[model samples]
Target: MGARCSKFSLCWWPSHIRSNRHDSSDVDEKDSLPGFIEYSLDQLRAATSGFSPDSIVSEHGEKAPNVVYRGKLEDDRWVAVKRFNKLAWPDSRQFLEEAQAVGQLRHMRLANLIGCCCQGEERLLVAEFMPNETLSKHLFHWENQPMKWAMRLRVALYLAQALEYCSSKGRVLYHDLNAYRILFDQDANPRLSCFGLMKNSRDGKSYSTNLAFTPPEYLRTGRVTAESVVYSFGTLLLDLLSGKHIPPSHALDLIKSKNFLMLMDSCLEGHFSNDDGTDLVRLASRCLQYEPRERPNAKSLVTALAPLQKETGAPSYVLMSIPQVSSSSKQTVPLTPLGEASYRRDLTAIHEILEKVGYKDDEGVANELSFQMWTNQLQETLNSKKQGDAAFRAKDLSTAIDCYTQFIDGGTMISPTVYARRCLCYLMNEMPQEALGDAMQAQSVSPDWPTAFYLQAAALFSLGMDDDARESLTDGASMEAKKHRN
Candidate 1:
């Protein structure tokens, strides 16, 4: 099974040095964590005239991401107040933690974290309001009015520098580095914001995510190393260059073909000069390197982005560059009817949320459509695979993984099947570092699948752990008759 499974994108059991990059710790608690803007819910109400809709400076229509409030701080500086409605409460603690961190770490490129209000089950974060909105707005907001590459480069520099500051402060992880999180200043400099999910290790595991901005390691393991952040930075660069959310495709293959220049954002078609675009692309590629150790840190990122700043005077945005391959390669994946049920169930949950939000409003429809389009795209990808293969295919690793997740999530998948499918996904997703997670997950649900150990060993090897993989492979080799049967 191990020999059959190895591929260009083999799962490697990765290194383990957990950093609760995005989760909060209780060592200091809310009290010891200083720098509170110290205002009651009532004061906040007065600032924004009782959270009036008219006070809203900007709302993009997403029911959850929407920030509703208009307010003035006591010092007379205008501010934008973002309040978390009941729907976002589950992620609210993140907001409070960020409010504390960013509020204290002041910089010209950063918004003044005025303070926050956590009261009566209400959550609100206050920051100096930038009237201009996010950098993403000007770049991809409209194809006709794309931002000049110069501006994006400047934004990248600003982001890198800000992250450098955060990273230097002993240890702090700015978890969300997407375009939406970057608010622009009057002069067009970008300040990282929306940091409710920033990770600062104190005690216990405190962060979890599968955001595209994140590295596969964090998705598989609940930890944040600076290298993972660099990986995310690369993706952001790609977005900046492309002015679109480029999906995970065969990027590594593109780079290998030396045609990575073609992957430049369509908006920069004519603007890219010889050897110029290549500079930024190279920077992006470096950040996207699979091995976290191989990637640069924010400090190095600052150096990488500096050239563009010198060339253009402003920063250019880059989309998150990734090793451009589908999460699947030539690795076998098993499909079971149980996985289909979980997928349907996950869809139902999404649909139910839409219903609760009364998806009749234009914004609601837009957000729902965006989400459905994503799901539809996934379905189309899966359908394309199912049409070609029946039981298992080496190339269907990621697709099968998704299929199985849907099944398991739907609560219909049996024990061994769940592990079997998950093992495939974890391996292909470049998370060999976490095959054992599913081992535990599967073991909790059911036991007696020796195949898991074999799969785990492969995952371990992918991360360059030959000894572990060899040991597990020996245990999981199964009988020669069972193998030759294939």
Candidate 2:
């Protein structure tokens, strides 16, 4: 008997699977993608701690058809370990094929597959764990403040781009798409789950999917096509518009009557302009059209929502930091320096916020720091930067790294020059991974700086990504040339 047919009823024996990163170039073109890892059963069991109950993450708890567990690999990376029901994937090879196909999909808006384990009858998939949780949690059952209007618009664009990317890759049939499948990454950006593609092949029954969110065609025909995915995307748009889960038919009625105000989430009362609201509502209305052929494709949807993206350069966390409306009134609560730092991740913004709302004592006194203490800390950060600059000039790589790291960790106002200088330090220290992270962060803070790209190329080259490094170097050179030309 094959591993898939091994005797195990209902429950899958927890496998101890070891994860190994597989290079794309080494993969047989017919089998798997570059990053796909096939873990040993031992590693999987160890990572999930014998698949403990604590690992289960689904709202249905452990009672759901398939259970998802949060696990940590030996590399210290967090991942979601989803163990599928035996019946769902009776053929292990089929599951692997589909998984490998989805694994090849790489998009900023999509959660890429990390690895999988297939030992005996156990069929498990591992994916990057999103720290910010799901869209459904933030929308209907918000714990913190409501998601901002700008953030919602950004989410819409992101989801659209994800679908567009998947469809372009020929993985057209996305079964039972919903907000729950969309997770928020570390930066508060939305990432569509790769598991969304690995669901049971189109059958009449839609298991565990919210009926209200399901497209009418799926309910009637018991099949999913490319067009059917559009219908599901339309429902997701409706969810963004109304925080509550309103059925497509009912939402259509609200749209037809031009009672969009009633359809809009009460928490988003003043944040959005009427025109923007109307535009999104109109787009949703088109998406919810009964006939699959009548619904717009993901490409068109992206095009339509492109204009609604107001803050293209704003970090996702910063967008979410905007004060949320409640009871038809907008509120602006001043944030603490650390709170601002946590959201904006921009040193300049953090410093400005700190200055505007200076350090406070227990009684909320302004300028809590005495002159000497404040000056000492500020001078320390500046001195570190200056030392780092001096060391870099002298090619003292180790000293440059130490000073740059101190300056960055000191939490002073962020300077692009300092980050660029530190990134070079990291590269020279033979820490390409750290160098890449700093280079990317620098780009995030000062997007147009070609020096960031130049550093990124060096880091990539050091990391053994020759082609990618060359591309980055080319981009940096071109940007620098353009800048000089102007």
Largest TM-score belongs to which candidate?
2
Q: Please report how far candidate 1 places residue 329 from its true position, in Å.
A: 59
TM-score of 2: 0.59
Off by over 4 Å in 1: 1-36, 57-68, 85-98, 194-197, 200-213, 310-486
**Ten contiguous residues minimizing lDDT sum, candidate 1:** 318-327
| Tens digits of per-residue lDDT for model 2, 197-246 | 87563222443456766777778887788787888787788888888878
Instruction: Name the 10 consecutive residues with the lowest summed lDDT in model 2.
Output: 1-10
- The TM-scores of all predictions, comma-separated, are 0.51, 0.59
What TM-score, to 2 decimals, does candidate 1 have?
0.51
In terms of lDDT, the best-performing candidate is: 2
lDDT of 1 by residue, 1-486 (tens): 111332222232223311212111111223322355757888788777778885776553443354645575444345678776545545557656766765666555565566887776677777766544576666676422567666667678777877776666554465646677788643335677734334442212233233544577877786777777677778788887667766434455566688876667776787767576777777888888877788888777777766555344212222211011111221112111122111122223322332243312122111122565556564554454353233224445566566555544533223453454455456556675565566445433433333445445545556676555544443333221123223
Candidate 1 C-alpha RMSD relative to the actual structure: 23.7
Per-candidate count of clashing residue pairs (backbone under 3 Å): 50, 15
